[model samples]
Every structure is written in structure tokens, then in C-alpha cells.
Target: MSKKEKFEELLKRLQEISEQLESEDLGLDKAVKLYEEGIKLSKLCHQKLEAAELKINELKSDVTAK
Candidate 1:
């Protein structure tokens, strides 16, 4: 799969985990595991966002240079 596909899958899993955690029936251990996964997902998502921001900044710089 492509990087975009992996990112999208991670995002979907994050959303599912978020919803599951919202439920009161989740066990403590399971919640901890989900929280770890969520932290990983959040970091990956932040990295992607930062990359996109950098790309946008590059494009803006090019536009200004022209």
C-alpha cells in the first residue's frame, strides 16, 4: 500500500479506537493498549500534517519568488 493509504487506514483505526474508548465498558488493560495505539496514531498524523505544512510553505515561497 501507498503512504497515503497507510495514513488513511491509521486515521480510521484512530477514529474507531476513539469511539471504543468512549464506551464505559472497556477494561483498564485494553484501554491502556488502545491509548498507546492512539498515541502512535496521533504522532503519525502530526508528522503527516507537518510534512504537508512544509510542502505548502515551499509552494508559497516559490510563488513569492516568481
Candidate 2:
């Protein structure tokens, strides 16, 4: 999958994780696993945001150069 597609999928996973975390009856082990997944998702989201920022900067430069 492309970086963009992966990023979108990660976002959906993050939302699922969030919903799972919100449930009051989650077991400790499952909660820990979900927390770890959430951390991974957060990192991926940050990386995607940075990549998008870089792309926007590149586009701005290209527009200015034209």
C-alpha cells in the first residue's frame, strides 16, 4: 500500500483502538495491548503529518519557482 493508504488505514485502526479503550470492561492485558497499538498509531500519524508538511512545502516551492 502507498504511504497515504497506510496512513489512512492506521487512522481507522487508531479510531477502533480508541473505542476499545473507552469501554469500561476491558481486561488489563487487552488494554495494555491496545495501548501499545495506540502508541504505534500515534507515531504513524505523526510521521504522516510530517511527510504531508514536507510535501506541502515542496509544492509551495514549486509554485514559487514557476
CA lDDT scores, all candidates in order? 0.82, 0.82
Task: Candidate 1: give the clashing pairs.
Answer: none
**In candidate 2, which residue ranges exceed 4 Å CA deviation?**
1-5, 53-66
Cα error, residue 64 of model 2, in Å, equals 32
C-alpha-based local distance difference test score of model 2: 0.82
Query: Model 2 Cα RMSD, Å?
Result: 6.4
Model 1 C-alpha lDDT per residue in residues 1-66, reported as the tens digit of each score: 326548788889999999998899999999999999999899988877776632333333556656
Per TM-score, the best of the predicted structures is 2
* After superposition, candidate 1 runs with Cα above 4 Å error: 1-5, 53-66
lDDT of 2 at 14: 95
Residue 11, candidate 2: Cα error in Å is 0.7
lDDT of 2 by residue, 1-66 (tens): 336457778889999999999899999999999999899889978877776643333333556666
